[model samples]
Target chain A: MRATLALMQSRLDDSPHLLRLGRLFSETVLIEVDGAEYYLTFRDGHLAAIAEGPSRKTPWRFALRTDADALAQFWQPRPRPGFHDLFGLVKIGRGRIDGDILTLVKNLRFFKEFMALPRTAPQPEETA
Target chain B: MTFEPVTGRYLTVTVQGRRQRIYVEMAGTGTPVLCLHTAGADTRQWRHILNDAELTATHRFFAFDMPWHGKSLPPEGFQTEEYLLTTDAYIETVLAVSHALGLDRPILAGCSMGGRIALQLAALHADRFAGFIAIEASDFQPAWYDIDWFHRPDAHGGEMGAALVSANISPHAPDAERWNTLWMFMQSGPGVFRGDLSFYTRDDSLIGRLARIDTTRTPVHLLVGAYDLTCTPEDARRTAAAIPGATCTVMDELGHFPMSEHPAGFRPFFADALARMKVADHV
Candidate 1:
């Protein structure tokens, strides 16, 4: 799971669309996966930091919560319903989002595309 | 109502002066509904519609694969080359298939690329169809996303294409339906998706042509999924407004590939549109 977040950070850094879409917004977001928390710091349209565990000093603009299983399925090559998207997970009771609804709505496309990056990345080799 | 097995066969037809073998599937009996599959997809997209006992009993559903798509291989001479479907070729194929099958003013229904062609048919040859049903279609697709990602060499026949498609699948759809929709994308032939997009995003333009359609002769109906980013409900409404008397309906909990993504959820909307078309036909 940590590796997936690291891969996501790399993908987000390299994505021109995400950078362009998120250029106007600068905020820290909290993504909680089954009690585990990760903080994403976006600055000047790029992902500046991805730190695991909650941040006590920095105030998060938004917080999204979901089970680890749902997060895993969302990153699958082809995810099923209830896991295909963040909003979809919420719709099916697998996930939820709180705080800064406006920020989320204003940059919905960027966030949606950003989270979907793992699916487009090359899969890791399977070990025997 | 009980579901019945659909019968499938290959029909020889001359499209664009080239002899091609088109694979067609048919079920039920009554008013002929000629269904067109979305780009890179085949007749299987209409499985739910074909198997619906009520729809079948009232109307005969026919879905055909375009040349070089699904079971319909390209003509013998062009087997080795990459097949790129153009607007002209697509229109001609649909016309040729309809003529070959001797369908009398069949109701033409299509989704995505198929949906776009429905408008082209109405604009160019309105008399050939009883009614036109366009799902997730629009006059223009804004360059919002990078289409090149789907065509990247590394992504070819890999998870990238399927992943992109899965994103468009409605998150509200059932798990089985979402997986089934992704299966279609995974099974599509190489370069077929990109080739289809050439027509979808590049060559096909119906902006000026929409006004030329005679709705009195052939009623046009537009249905869009609420969740479709490519062809949003607003786009469908704009298209509907352009064509005189064209009715537009926005389907909720549906996305780009509505029929395959959530056929059961989409059935009500499909039935409503078909019913309205039938009523308009009599009026």
Candidate 2:
């Protein structure tokens, strides 16, 4: 999951359109995979930090939770229905999103494209 | 419980005073359903719907490949030209094909670009269709992504186009379905996708025009896939809200190509839309 966050960061860094989409705001998002947590801090449209195991200092504007199985399926080369997207997973009772709903909706396209990074990002073996 | 095989053939139709051959496939008997495929796609996109035993039993399905698409080759003088599908040409071809086939107020079903056309048909020629089922359709889209990569001269034969389309398919879809979609993408003729996008992303703006749709005479049922980025669920909902009594269904776990990418998963939503249409017809 930490590796996945790293991959997401690199993908966001590489996309100019994504950066522009997020340029209007800054926020901290928490992604909870099972019991483990990761904090993603965005400063002025760029990903500033990807800290693991949660943070006591900052309050997350948005938080999403799902099990390890759901997260793994989401990152698969090809996903099946319930595993294809965050909303799809939520609809099927496999995932949940809490905290600031407006923040999520305001940057819906940015977040959607951001989460889909793994699909286009180079595989670990390919990079190695 | 059993069904016969679907039959396919080519039909010559005159559209805008120009003669062209179109590939048409049909199956079953009862209320006729004239299906329109998405941009850069052909009648093959309707294979799942055509082959569905239950759907075929109650509905006679007709799917056709547009000119320069699928097995339907463009006519003479058009062989060397760059093809750009305009909204006028698309509507003309659909009307011409329906007229040539002598279809009587068939229920129109379409997806993506085809879906936009279905909405247009309901608006312009409401009396010509019993009801129109539009999947992944909306009035306006604020061009979310940059599609210049699709028009790159070096990316002919749809390599980059296929890759981009593959990304839109839901990752949860079956492996076979995913590969089948890729096959369709790879099979599209060069520049056909970009040409189709001209109408999809540019000309087909049915925003204020949606209120002209008569829901009582011609019921419009829109089904948008939850994962469809091009025509998001919110877009469909907004479109539905503008049209009086127009129904909208947002299907979970489905993407842009709902009918083809994951037909089995999309079946329930499709079935529900048809059921709603039937109820509307009786009303």
lDDT of each: 0.80, 0.79
lDDT of 1 by residue, B141-202 (tens): 75433445445453344234565555567766766777777777668777777778778888
- Top candidate (TM-score): 1
lDDT of 1: 0.80
- Candidate of highest DockQ: 2
Model 2, stretches more than 4 Å misplaced?
A1-128, B1-4, B145-148, B279-283
Worst 10 residues of 1 chain B by lDDT: B151-160
Candidate 1 lDDT over A42-124, as tens digits, reads 88767788888855776899989998888878877646644667766776688888997656655666777777787854343
Clashing pairs in 1: none
Where does model 2 sit among the CAPRI classes? incorrect
**Clash pairs (backbone) in predicted model 2:** A79-B171, A79-B172, A80-B171, A80-B172, A81-B172
User: What is the lDDT for B64 in model 1?
Assistant: 95
> Against the native chain B, what TM-score does each candidate's chain B reach?
0.94, 0.94
Error of 1 at B274 (Å): 1.0
